[model samples]
Target: MENSLLVETISCTDGSLVGIATLNRPQALNSLDLEMTRILDKALKDWSQQPEVVAVIFRGAGEKAFCAGGDLHSLYDTMIEYKGQPASANEHANRFFAEEYELDYLIHTYPKPIICWGDGIVMGGGMGLMAGCSHRVVTETSRLAMPEINIGLFPDVGGSWLLSRSPGHTGLFLALTGALIGASDAIYCGFADHALARDQWEPLLQALQSTPWARTAEDFQKVTDLIHALPSIELQTGPLESHRALIDRICQEYDLERIGVSIAALSQNEDKWLSRAGQTYMNGCPGTARLSWELLRRARHMSLADIFRLEFGVAVECAAAGNFQEGIRAVLIDKDRQPKWEPATLEETAGDWMAPYFALSIDDPSHPLATLGR
Candidate 1:
């Protein structure tokens, strides 16, 4: 699938090279399938070893999205085939998640600067990839979220860690509501570093190519300076900022049950944004809400590697359950927008109900992501 991931090397002014990886499945919003994931991981690995490659830029091919999410269609198929089995029993999910997490971790710990052009829709796995990049650029069109709750999945791909770090309890609010936020909100949440007009992408690329490159700390600083030199775009205030007070107050509760009631009550508010977020939470998978909250809490203190390991198990366990499959079926296959979560309600998923998701599903002594951050 050469078309899936178009890898290129652009010669810089000083004879150094800038590696570019473009996610090419624009029709599908560049969603990562297993093959695309493998291609990207290999490309990144190869670039890391090439000293002449001073930096890497990741972007999707289309104007509509950088990447909407992962290849849910494929994951849905895998889940259907291995229904009722533990995460260890679902080999494809395990490998897909394992490789994806490894790829994300690599971006986080990459030896060189990585610029992620986060234009258009960036959510779920897309959020993961962008969050790892050192230079995260958002355009006027950038719309971001960790909306796994909608699909019966918690925010994987380092989302737990990413969300946990959001200002105040806005992270908890996002995890529970699957809210759609703009570039400003994304930047406010620390999901993006720079905000540029969409057209600046080309100019930014040209600037990068023209700069004298050095594969060192200077390169990272230069990349940052170049991006900062680009013309800025002023976006309208996003809901996250406007509703910060309310969001923080609602999520401040230590008990998720109390938080759920507060969030669900927003549906009746006169403000459409708050009401919509509230409705989304009300309609989302109870299991996902539970997992997202629990994971975000745990990720607050764990090392990045540990978060990935913990998410791997939760992802696999999600595959074993019916909610993930049903969420996919309704949202993607059936297009019905209805998912019947097994636990049925937040009240039902309380306490140790999430214990199984935290447990390692595989028998291997060496965890799949054990090599991360080593």
Candidate 2:
């Protein structure tokens, strides 16, 4: 109920059997800032301990988006604040990524049945929160992606853990191109659990809330049946679907150079969307793309805790590097839509450039989340 937090209410419907948490920042598309993350973390913990709260529902306030992303303006500002001092930037970066990762971990390991109503633009940090929920419900409006490459950062906030588990090379395709998936395609890629029409949300919530607390499983079944009754929203079709086969084939290459070559080949294709996505990748941060490839590849066998820890290290490295600030300047601050990346080609970003991300420093301790159980 705190006014500062993005979440609005913690109301119980169905006689306190279900708690509903609504993300209230409609104007900003319900972006999750640090304060909002702390608020959500606390709320989840609070409701999880309440015996009366049989289930919890997470949804955004407006129709535009479930959650767009984290408040990167704050992140950019923090980076700028420590522009002159490496120690200051590292200190701030560690705290930021650690808190964010901890919140993601909490969602992954929450005891209660946490249902997320992912209705619209769920990207980056939003995807992090949704991926960990017990039940992820997507609408036709849902447009999901891990677009950190666009911002000169590899997808963090547990992206390394979830994306690695996606089907075949689908995760790589998403990571490299920053492609957005609709509801059915999201379900196809294992990013979302249920695909329901937007209108069915209120009715579904009512049904979930009305279920008896003692017969939680039975009540959940009733709600599922109601959801099943809703009309099906068609999967992503046309050029997006046609391009998938080519994307899966081309992006399957482990080497970043081959991946770039494959993406460049798409430029000659007749498919406009693929061509645009190809161009986007061509123009995006080569260093970030390499980091993305490495992160997802390394994360394939890592535990969630380890993946988060590894990404924390990478994020700290990004803050130290100049790409994050330059990317933000071009894409967000300047709106010029052109980033002048250092060592602009994939060939320039060799193994040496990325070695520091994997190197452990004696000065820093292991992540506070090292204690996270599998």
Candidate 3:
């Protein structure tokens, strides 16, 4: 709309248009800007209504990332302006999350198949894009994580839905520690369905064009089967295998101090991955950690619509009072690596200071996503 070309749509041989939505900002890791989200929401909404558009393919332009996440710089700036008040803040924070969550919910309930080529780093907003697709593919080099805690944000891109259902307490551990997992772990956690060798990606793309399309009852299955038919990839069992027991132990304890202390203890682990993960939790914003834990707990039984609503509420609240601004300043703007969280300790992050985040105002029953999963 702004002539920025944030998303490019390509016509497929399947007929009128088998939408291929490419995230075009490679320099920024194809991150989702407000412009990009608006473009994607418009294009996908248009394509969803057209009968000739059999399926949609989502991918990134760069070699390094499918999408690292949403453009946090924009969010940081907007939050600074809005700061969580419903009346005026709704103009930015409310609208952004509302549109974003609407798009995510659409992807989940889409009648036609959606294929997300998860090639490289996929986190935060990136995870949101891939999570709802019917066919999700991972390459040998795919690096995936929720990683919201690092920025003083919970995994809002349907993170609560995906992570809550992860095997054992692995999701909780990942949410709090911002753990990065590989292709195999993605499949193990139900994040991805198929593995395609990086070298064979070209072949997969070619096959997509040559494949026949029909709006049959089994259209979704047919698309998924096509992707699965690609050459198999050998995925190494990453950290999840070795750290399963420890993650279960750490996450089963819901108390902020207990879980935080247990994970922080891993800072001394022999394994660098575990040690870094531990250090991440040891230093992450106390409010974000507690909020993530609560969301994951509540998400275990909520519907997809409810999860979106809940995430919207938390995101707005984070923008308003949580340490997200401080986190972004230290982690991105200042590069100082020192965020002064208000309630700096996990113990202090519990109780009233964290209540408003879970409460709903704009994200209530009359919310934009009320009929999301219906």
Per-residue alpha-carbon lDDT of model 2 for 188-299, expressed as tens digits?
7788889888988877766665555553455455556656766756665534455667767887776779988888777676867677678778888998888989988889
State which candidate has the highest lDDT.
Answer: 1
Off by over 4 Å in 2: 1-14, 87-90, 215-226, 236-241, 361-365
Better of 2 and 3 by lDDT: 3
Question: lDDT by residue for model 1 over 117-160, one digit each (tens)?
Answer: 99999988899999999999998888898888888889999999
In terms of lDDT, the poorest run of 10 residues in model 3 is 1-10
| Alpha-carbon shift of residue 232 in model 2 (angstroms) | 3.7
Each model's lDDT comes to 0.89, 0.77, 0.83
TM-score of each model, in listed order: 0.97, 0.91, 0.94
State the local distance difference test value for candidate 2.
Answer: 0.77
Task: List the lowest-lDDT window of 10 residues for candidate 2.
Answer: 2-11
- What is the RMSD of candidate 3? 2.2
> Once model 1 is optimally superposed onto the true structure by TM-score, how far is the C-alpha of residue 271 displaced, in angstroms?
1.2
* Total clashes for model 2: 0
Best by TM-score: 1
Candidate 1: the clashing residue pairs are none
Best-to-worst ranking by lDDT: 1, 3, 2
